[model samples]
Target: MLTYTPPIAEQRFVLQNIVKVDELSGHNVFADVTSDLVDAILEGAGQFAAGEFAPLNRVGDEVGSKWSPEGVTTPPGFKEAYGAYVEGGWGTLTGPTEYGGQGLPLSLSSVVMEDLGSANMAFSLIMMLSPAAVEALKHHGTEEQRRTWMPKLVTGEWNGTMNLTEPQAGSDVGALKTRAVPQGDGTYRIKGQKIFITFGEHDLTDNIVHLVLARTPDAPEGTRGISLFLVPKFRLNDDGTPGEFNDVRCVSIEHKMGIHASPTCVMSYGDRDDCVGWLVGEEQGGMRAMFTMMNNARLNVGLQGVSIAERATQAATRYARERVQSAKAGSASRESVRIIEHADVRRMLLRMKALTQAARALAYYAAGLTDRGQLGDADAQARVDLLTPLVKAYGTDVGVEVTSLGVQVHGGMGYIEETGAAQHYRDARISPIYEGTNGIQAADLVGRKLGLEGGAVLASLLSDMRAGAAGEAPLMALIEDCEAVAGHLATSSTDDRMAAAYPFLTLLSVAVCGWLMALQLRAAEREDGDSRFLAMKKAAARFYLDQVVPETRGLRAAAMAPAESLFGLDEEAFSA
Candidate 1:
């Protein structure tokens, strides 16, 4: 099993030095967010995740989530671990204070989630889904709905899920056929099936709140007609206790490649035509409400990538330090040396650490900006909008890259499941696909986010990167590349922009990450700290700038490639 040490020091450094979380305390909304509070959160979350969650990861994978006609049963110890999480108040860190929450900055919750996800990615999804639901209710749900649902979700006494995907409607939410009909009592009768609903029917909690997307009869066609609804597994009584079945049933759980304990359910709603739901937000406004939830989930999904990458880096580093192999090529001694002594292994380890740190930096930076935006910083909000797709797309891409490298570093043992390196790879494989596929993330970035403030958002980001680069030539060149590509995207046809989206996304993401790394390098060099840790930080920062940032050059060329190469290919050409 891979033992996860929560990288507490690294998180503290990023929050304090890089993201400068302490500065948030100056805002009225964050008046209570002190250094001690931040430290307490990181420490407490680390202990719970490592002690209660990590040990169950292996069993969770082996036994997986069991499916019965009644409901889905999570692997052994998961229920208890979840109870402890709720009791410890881990989930309430970012919830509204009026709703029994701690009212901390959202970034603090990101820090906690990184640790938890590192320890157990599958279990962390249960925690992750609830916050998205909370955000949706906070932004769009009625006041009564908030009073009814927010507190329980905040306290983790109840769980929540986003039911957007159906069997026929995967990425195209507009294609969903789920119907919501008014029942004349200010409620709705929801009838449809949803699939790939994570934690949709888990037994960890007695009640599950589902934020489902459905269309009311007589509504306009397409996404404009879709409405969001609050449908629960069990209806609440007058006293707000679980009373009767709400006709939400889990037809089955998917057999998956990884994160086996997280139930990806096929949910059938209103099988008996009795499923009751309350309309959330206005009818024909589901897309707007759903985006509020989705944008939140997309960022956290990116955080999942960072979390998994961190764990894989630690596992690989430990293995490289302990696994003995052939001696140095030019050494006189015949004695075997640890694999870390070998150049290739050292390269892999350094790349893993550097990329993991870059991903974490990107995620934390976005989180910090989110807090600033919440505090009424218009520019910060604009930057966050531009960075959201980058964080979601790039962070998960790094997660997949680093975990795969973790497996390679373990050599043959990594191939076997017991060593745990392979599991990291498998678990990470889903992140780029989850929330929204990385392709969609790329498309969103180029098609919409790049156009924010008429391209000023991206221009400002590039200008800041150029200034912060401090005359680093490679970064300067990459910034130029991003600028040129942004101009191209703005002028290009729809097909051209779509064709360029993926690579353009990578190009811009690496540029931003490289810029952040450069800033961290300066901070690390100035800090008077443990020589080894600071030295490692400096090395990783330098490695990323010198090695990783250059990859963007090729990406830039690919981003500007003609759309004809893609559209020119017929369907048969892709069929092998």
Candidate 2:
């Protein structure tokens, strides 16, 4: 059995020292959310996760969710766990107060979500998608739409999903073929098949609300033609209760390598002629509206990456402490020593811990940026936008790497089904692939973020890095790396621009992560006594700077190279 414990002390270090939750409460919008309140929420969430969610994690993987012609059934204990989650109001933490939510800040909710994911990622995902759907509706839905669905969704009586992928259009929204024809009766008939829809069909909720993206008859070609709509599993009556079953049906569920508890469905919309949907926002504006949720979803997915890595690291660390193997060097007897005493095992464990901590700091910093964008000074929004892709892409990329290290630490046991480390590795594999793949994230950073405000965002970020370092050696070295790459991008001509952008983005991610680790190290320095927490932070920062930051050089070379190297490769050359 996996002995999982939330890193409560480390979480406090992040919220208090790294991000400064107290500083956020000083803002007017967050005046109601105090540090004390945040602590209490964290405590409650940690307890609930350990008590309610952790126990079912293995059970979920063992039993898995079952699918039949009738409907999909979640693994045993999921329904009761979900009911407890709803009753505890965990689902409504970030929803609008007008819709029966607690109206907490995204930062607090992010902390709670990290705990949930650490406890049980598959179970947590079902709750995670609901608020994202509610956020989309809150931003773009009409008054009637909000009145009819917000209460149920915000209360967790119903769950939500985003339907975008088709058999051929995965990640390429422009290639989507879903069609929606306006009915002149203020509704539209939707016809499309959506694959890889998470929580698409679940028995936990009375009804499932799908925020589907499709195209109108007269819509433009490619992505410009895309539009979003609210399609429910069951049409609602005037009384806000589910009426007749909507035309949506689950054709099948994917048998994935992991996260077996979370059903990934292939759903058919409008298999019958009566599949109805209401427009969200306006025609040709669906992608824009979906971005509201997609952006949030991207950040949450990053946290999922961090959460899984943390859990895996904890499991591996605990296993190392107890699992005895060969005797230590110069031992008098043949008595076995704990695996943690072995140098190689210790190195791997340290790498896992360091990477997990660095990734956690990056994710939390991004969440703090979100809170700042919502309630801080006017200039904070740009900073938030710049870090969004870094948090989403870099964090998840590190997550897959760290979790894989965790599995490696356990040797053959990690490969065994019962060890549970394999599950974390499997669950993390998807984080980098979904919510805009990491490649797209890299492209967005170079194409959009670097160019935001005519390159002022990148410029401002560099300036902040210099100021934050204050001539400290480690920090100054990182800032210099950032400037060198930025200068390369700045001076590049049109012919070499795209080629330069790729490596620049990769180097930029490393620099940002290194800078964050430096900040954490600085904080650890200020704390009194040789506490393990502070020591771990310092060690992790050192390992990241020495081992991880050097990768920027290779990335920089790649970014500065000619694009033809990749594009000029012969397609037929590999056949031999």
Candidate 3:
């Protein structure tokens, strides 16, 4: 049935030890955040996730969300689960204090999100998109706009969605044809169709605030002409309550391979030619405002990878321990033993555990850095810009790989729908493709991020890796490889850089992950308490360094491969 144990202990280890989240308490922003508070938050969230969300995962996937002209109906029990989530104040974790929120660190909220996503990945999307909208409005919206919308959105009474994709404009935001004409009053008449909008239409919240991108009548062509608008499903009254229908219609929802409970809607704005929206920023500043929301989502999407992988790993491990299969290779007993006793099964389980922990560390580190950056650390912000793509691309990639391994661990039973292993893999497949496809993330890594601060960002990261490596030969070698390939791509042509993007991203991500894991190992080793959890940390870190991190060597080679090899025979050569 795919039970999840919350992994609170592991999350604590990463938060307190690896990321040194406790250190953030010294800052005025996180002054009230004591270690005890962190522990209590983790414990409370863990219980809520296990008790409320875990049991509904199978049902959510099996029944999915039902759609009609009225609106989208979430699977049974989903509405109640969402109610509990809202009433419990779960969505207000990292929100601003002025808008009736707790104003906690992004790092803390990230762990809570990991727990929620682990319990129910499909259902968690309802909570994930709201805070991002709050962030967008907080950063780019006017004072009146923030006062009007931020409170309910922060409180989870309303949900938010980023409406950017059209039938023709997928990744290319410049190609969207959505129009927003100024209405002489404060609002604009918005007319467009947006596809693949997650949580676009759902029954969980009363109002859905859509941050949409459209172009003005006299706007220039392409992305420069695009502008962001705050459009709601129902127009607000003078008292800030949902009043009238705003012509925001859900034409239909998509039937997909995974996250069936998350409604990916084909949304039509101004079907009646009366939909009203307010400009978020300037007339042609949509891309800037949208990126604020997207960057937040990209990190959470990376955490989604870690969350699903953790769930899948636990499921696979539990099955391995209970399902009796074959005798051990060197055992004398003829009777069948648990599959976990088999060396190969042990190998797969270890790999899953190692990769899951590594990805979690990477994502958490990025989140923690975000908190630091928010506190006005310029260097931390620069480092964060570099790590965002790595966390997004590599973290989601690990989710897909680890979930696939979970299926392989279950063997024939994994293929059966009843076992629930298949769902994890299916759900994970979308993470790499959405929130900016992993390929685009990789391209961003090599093309843009690699050149941050005129190459100083990469250099700073390498210096940290060197310090973390602490003369460990394998880790040091991988760091050198990352540096070499990064240098090669710097001087390479556009085609060459694009060709090497994916591999370089993988290489650099592994190097950074290796450094983080090494830090965890050192922390574990230094602890005086001889606990089994600490022992597990040491082992996972060792395995990651010994086994997984070494893949960087080959990736470095691929990163350095000439673009000529890719272009030698381009058009129709394969068919010939």
Candidate 4:
């Protein structure tokens, strides 16, 4: 079986030294996190992910999740592994201490997530859902709601799901048709069919808190009228244990391209007309509340991209080191040499490592900004607003590319299921599509985020990226292209903006990741560290700068092209 060895050293190096969780230690939310505690936590999370979760990745993919009249049954060992996970308080890393959580910085939680994703992407998802719900509830839940559900959800005794997508509504959440009828006692009877609900109907927990988006009878039209509701699978008893079954039912789950172990269900609310939901924030305020969870969820999905890349890289590099192939170019003997000795194989391995490492650093940096933003840093909030989309779109794009390279490295064996390279590729396919498609993310960067503070955020961000590129000529050249593209995006017409957003976002993402990778190298040079690892870090930065950074030129040109051709395509012409 293929295995995952957590990059504990690299994680600690980034968190403790580079991103420096200590910067946020001054905040009350992060006050309890000491260096010793943080180290222990990282080590523990790594152990859990590798020893417990990694062993389950293949099993989960093969067995997948099973559904029946009794609900969903997870692949074997998932429930037990999750049980151990919660018992060890792994779920509490980012939860609030008031609700029995550790309250460490999100950057720390981000590192833990990397480990978990590397181990078992499907299983890590169940853990991810609760946290998004926790964030929404933590920010929007009423006192009674918090007191009742926060502890259970945070501790992983229960799970949660986001219910927004329907048959007709996908990204255009404003088109949703779910309805809510006020029951006069501050409760609402919710009736809707929500699709792509992960962990929606599963035996992992008796009570699954689903945050649903619905429309009230008297509410206005469009997204402005949608309201958020907290609907539990099992009705709560007077004493807090699950009482009767709520009207939430799993109609079916998706037979997807990847992450099969994760049950993506089509959920029906009020199937029996008895489904009761309490308002989460206020009526006609669902989109606002959902975005709160989504911005962070977008980040989580981006990290999934990073996780898959790490797993694929590890598998491919291992195979390269062991798989004996052609002898070195100048070798005299007829003896076969390991693939790692071949130049092209080494290039592929280094490229995979470079992109994965850059993506990881960029993700960790964005997560650090998340904590800073939460701590009332206005600049950090602006940074988060801008970086979130790029992280999701670019990170996942790199993930797909890197995983494909992993398959390339494995040669014939990669095509076979037993090598496990294909699984990472299959699992990564969903990251760019979910939590807002990469296209939407790019448009968000170009249209919404670029307009922040009358375009000062994008301008200032580019300025800093240029400054960071100080001595690196390739990065400097890329920064210039990115800055020019930003200028075009800032002034482009709506049609042009829509056409160029994707390439613009890709160029900017590459520049930013290159910048972060540069930062990692400088930090490595300054700090007293492991020589071999530090050398590897410098080498990765070099590869990213030299081999991968040139794509920005082409991306910039495509981004600057006219939108007319795209708009001119006829429906039938487009189909061809």
Q: Please give the lDDT score at residue 246 for candidate 3.
A: 98
How do the candidates rank by TM-score, highest first?
A: 1, 3, 4, 2
**lDDT (C-alpha) at residue 560 in model 4:** 91
lDDT per model, in order?
0.91, 0.83, 0.92, 0.89
The residue ranges of model 3 lying beyond 4 angstroms of the native Cα positions read 574-576
What are the per-model C-alpha RMSD values against the true structure?
0.9, 2.0, 1.0, 1.3
lDDT tens readout by residue for model 3, 12-93:
8899876788889999988978999899899999999999999999999999998899999999999998999889998888
Pick by TM-score: 1 or 4, better one: 1
TM-score of 3: 0.99
Q: Report the C-alpha displacement of residue 248, candidate 1, in angstroms.
A: 0.4
Per-model TM against the reference = 0.99, 0.95, 0.99, 0.98
Tens digit of lDDT per residue, candidate 1, span 447-498?
Answer: 8999899888888888889899986898889889989988988899999999
TM-score of 4: 0.98
Better of 2 and 4 by lDDT: 4
Task: Encode model 2's per-residue lDDT on 1-576: one tens digit a residue.
Answer: 475687887888888866788888777777778767887888899999999999999988877787888889999999999999989988888788888987777878888899889899988888777888988999899998998999889888999898988999888888999999999999999998999999899899889999999999988889888889999999988788999899999988999888889999999999878999999998889888888888888889989988898899998998899899998777787889999998888889888887788778878887887778777455567877887787888778878988898888888999986888899899889888888888788777766777788888788877777766564565566567666766666666654666665556657777777777778778888887558878888998888777777645566557667667756869886675
Off by over 4 Å in 2: 329-335, 470-475, 490-503
lDDT of model 2 at residue 497? 62
